[model samples]
Target: MYIHHSDVQVVFMFTERFIRYIQFEKRYSPHTVSAYQSDLDQFTGFLNNPQKLSPPPPPVITHPSQITHYHIRNWMVELMNQHIIARSINRKIATLRKYFKFLLQEGVIEINPASKINTPKIPKNLPVIVEDVKLTQMLDDNEVFGTDFKGLRDKLVIEMLFGTGMRLSELMGVKDSDINEYEGTIKVLGKRNKERIIPVNNELKLLIAEYQELKKKQDFFGNNSLTLIVTDKGANAYAKLIYLIVQKYLSYISTQNKRSPHVLRHTFATSLLNRGADLNAIKELLGHANLSATQIYTHNSVERLKSIYKQAHPKA
Candidate 1:
């Protein structure tokens, strides 16, 4: 229950170095770096250590080489008993696996206990989506737009989401140069910095093009100036703003389920699938790393079929 101060410092130093390795050497996005940092912080917190420190307690591990399967088993048991969801615990295990792999490469640990530990299996739940009538109502609810810069910006935000099926992060990261006029496509840098071109329908592109013209008339200037979506204050929109925008609009239109920005993405995927778009084609447009991730939209179609059967079948 005690680690040398020097050892703790080494761990901290290594983490900083590893973060840089992932960001620059590995070309990971800032979001990924932040997630890894958070996972490491949680893991370090669980280590029972006795150390003399000023205000905040520091980690102190005795016999670092002795980290064994029992420790990992005990951690899993603690997490399970606390009712932590299986998905979260699974992610925590992944974090540890990555960390230990790094430690092994550095010769800090003789063996990776995490490799021997089994991760909890999480059941997949059906994604919540807005129904057709409610979705129509929400998209048509332009009353959220009022006579002001903020209102115009908010309305454009929702319009872009429902119109384009862009991820909340993708919408926020958009820039002026990322849009195309002649081809009517958008260049989005998605997860892992993978770039994909999504075709923009004429209606949405014209709206965006017009919005750009209006923005230029204002003659705004800043370091983050090129961002397509922004606050009235002219800063880039955060993920929270996107969430709130969707939440407010969805509340006014739908009572079926909790409506978030992801629901818009789900709505987009399902709508496309129902309209007879190819599944693999939708996969590429959504910037999913794998087809399986995009395949969840099929469940929504199944639910739709169930609803149709319950309502129209004469067997009752």
Candidate 2:
């Protein structure tokens, strides 16, 4: 199949414009924009070379307009054959749907080929959460997390995530100025650059103050950057470091199969709901875009209630 240079250029131009729109106009995070770009790249790769093992030349689609529903279906089928999970495939499909939607709105295409495609049904897996008692015990145990700078930082990282229900990205983005000590609130820049103020308890505020003091004692190098968390070298803390910190502490407390910062976030929300905190309040604290996202924690709360009833009720 012959592909024209101009045709490929046209597709590239549309993709570029769409990326710009999402990044600047829509205010999507860099991570999200990269995921969308990756999905498109994978789709284009499939169109260019559909058959990896079998060597009969595959159908070539040089332009986005040339992409049809059949092409999308084939791509999805191939993705399934490669053992990609339904959730990931659905995300890729969503990316394509958004891209085609953009093209349709911009008058580049008369019809959106990805419009009619069905998203794969994903299994409803409840999020993992640490028990409140276990977490509190762990936090209170100074021997577990020592008095050193790294130890204090790690402890604060866990507390901030669980206390505020902030996402890892949001926690990392937190600056010194974002924390209002007097107001007892920390400002978090959430997804799509949305800012929300989450109230911090007195204990958490003191922990922040202690961390800041310890941070100053170190050879801190983040002169211009106001990031709250920093590396041992005094640079900004990366995701992997935070993940390892959460994983290490969580392993000591809970035997859950999954232990990460997100699990701490789940613990935060579930603890709130178990204690009768309003769903909308949890949503705002977590900086969730919608109430539906916050509603998932209710399942954990319900499960906990069921377990309590089963244990304590007269009728088994």
Candidate 3:
């Protein structure tokens, strides 16, 4: 069954239903949810601190029903007084908005006071891209990678991220059976456990075949995990190891500071966009739930075009 982002977040929840709702149901990343949780906690503390809030010394509001739009406005003021940036304040406001929305859905509150709250404006930051030439040179450079299992795996990690544009989590989840070498396609499980097929080139299939052969030779540390990528000890691949592999190798060819797996993901989309691939096709390959998420690459593509124009055009 297809689970909504909110429902998926709900499934990932642990002990506290509230946070679990934020993470799995609300679909906010754990880091963002942590900040939101902190914001709510701070707001709760502020509510109890009668002096800090505008007086008649309002009574403590321990329930969502007790919250009013006025209290939220007062909290925003408090955040500004602390010299918080508009973006940070907006996030806090967002936390309350989500919180109130959840409460309203659960029938704990009749009105979402945060519903009417206006958020401060913030600047947009585009995704970072690794230049295709640099990646091409790096991958083509045999000296940079060893013929050994670890080295081949490292190269495969970079290749799959750039080649297929799958997220790091999806890469970690790849099993030996996920690749359809004959069709030259890879099926990856993306966010919320959604699966999508990304076409692989003949080169990538060969690389995977080689990696699998090496992987088979790897001793079984524990019941021989079927997970595609694995540690030296033969356990399944994990997030940190995959990150380190990307970072370590990318550092060899490019000096760009951000070399995480997601950067390769961004690079993949940017590369496709730059090469005139259809936006919708890119969206499907990346397994984005919406085209808006995939549209960010168009901005990167525009910037790259402008950069090329400046170098080639001779109006001097």
Best by TM-score: 2
* Candidate 2 lDDT over residue span 1-316, tens digit each: 3446676677789999999999999988766888999999888767666453233333554667777787788888899999999999999999999999999999999999998899789898888888889999989999999999999999999999988999988888898889899999999889878989999999999999999988887857345547999987788888889999999999998887799899989989999999999999888888888998888888898898999999999995
The parts of candidate 2 lying over 4 Å away from their true place are: 1-10, 52-59, 219-222
TM-score of each: 0.86, 0.89, 0.72
Candidate RMSDs in order = 4.2, 2.8, 7.3
> Which prediction has more favorable TM-score, 1 or 2?
2
What's the CA error at residue 53 for candidate 3, in Å? Answer: 6.8
| Winner by lDDT between candidate 2 and candidate 1 | 2
lDDT of 3 by residue, 1-316 (tens): 1224554343224114667776776575444556767777687667656665554333433345766787788888888888898988987887788777877887777999998888777767799777888998889888888899889888898999988888877888787788888888888776655778888988888999888877767653244688788877778787889989998988876788888999999988888888889999999998989999899788888887898889999962
TM-score of 1: 0.86
lDDT of each: 0.75, 0.86, 0.78
Q: List the residue pairs that clash in candidate 2.
A: none
- How many clashes (backbone N, Cα, C below 3 Å) per candidate? 2, 0, 5
What's model 1's overall lDDT? 0.75
Candidate 1 lDDT by residue in tens digits, 210-296: 677667665543445878987667777777788888888788778766788878888888999888899999999899999999898
